[model samples]
Target: MLLINCPFCGAREEHEFHYGGQAHITRPADPEQVDDKAWADYLYYRKNTLGLQAERWQHSFGCGQWFNALRCSQTHQFKAVYKMGDDAPEGLQ
Candidate 1:
């Protein structure tokens, strides 16, 4: 099993956490003004990178706060975990 390091609870099993998708993604303010293409991009589009990826994760069984994680998509290995407002590493973006 993959061990995910929780920002609050340290390292733990992956099942304890829930994936919250890509981080820093914000919804459009004007829904009606947004065209179908923009709507589809926001709803269905995602960056499926192979290397390190910045993703949002929730510590459901612990503090229950949303945090950002720098993880490797290919290996499912987490390199770092930080709170929502915390600054991400230089290579993340």
Candidate 2:
């Protein structure tokens, strides 16, 4: 089983956390101005990179704060964990 470190509650089982998908993706200010293609891209598309992915995770069983994690997709290893609004470290971005 993989262990995920919750920034608010320390480490815990991976099942306790919920994957919130890719982080740092922002929505357009004007919904009407956004084209269908752009909306679809924002809603359905993802980078899906292999190594060193920056993603948003929620500590569902812990302090319940949404945080960012640098995780390896292949081995499910976490490199670093940080709260929202904080810098993503040098390598993660």
Candidate 3:
């Protein structure tokens, strides 16, 4: 299994955390003004990149805090891990 590093709790097994899907997704400014298609796309569309990708994760069994990580989807290797609201590391973005 993947060994994920939690920003609040330090390194832990992947089973101790929960994957929160792709990061940096912004919701529509006005939900009522959004059409059906746009809303649907926002809810389901994801990059599903092959190489390095940024993802949101939660330390469910530990601190219960959310964080972002830059990892390679193919290799399951994490390049960086940071707390929520922090920008991704330079050169990796």
- lDDT string for model 2 (1-93, tens) is 888989878889988999999977878788789999999988899999988888999998777889999888988889999988777888565
Top candidate on TM-score is 3
Clashing pairs in 2: none
- lDDT per residue as tens, model 3, 1-93: 778888877889989988899988889999999999999989999998999999999999989999999999998999999987888999997
Give the top-scoring candidate (lDDT).
3
For model 1, residues 1-93, the per-residue Cα lDDT tens digits are 988888777888888899999886778999899999999998999998888889999989777878999988988888889889877887655
lDDT, model 2, position 58 = 95
Error of 3 at 63 (Å): 0.8
- RMSD list, candidates in order: 1.9, 1.5, 1.4
Better of 2 and 3 by lDDT: 3
- TM-scores vs. true structure, each candidate: 0.80, 0.86, 0.89
Off by over 4 Å in 1: none
Q: How many backbone clashes does candidate 1 have?
A: 0
Candidate 1 minimal-lDDT segment of 10 residues: 84-93
lDDT (Cα) of model 2: 0.87
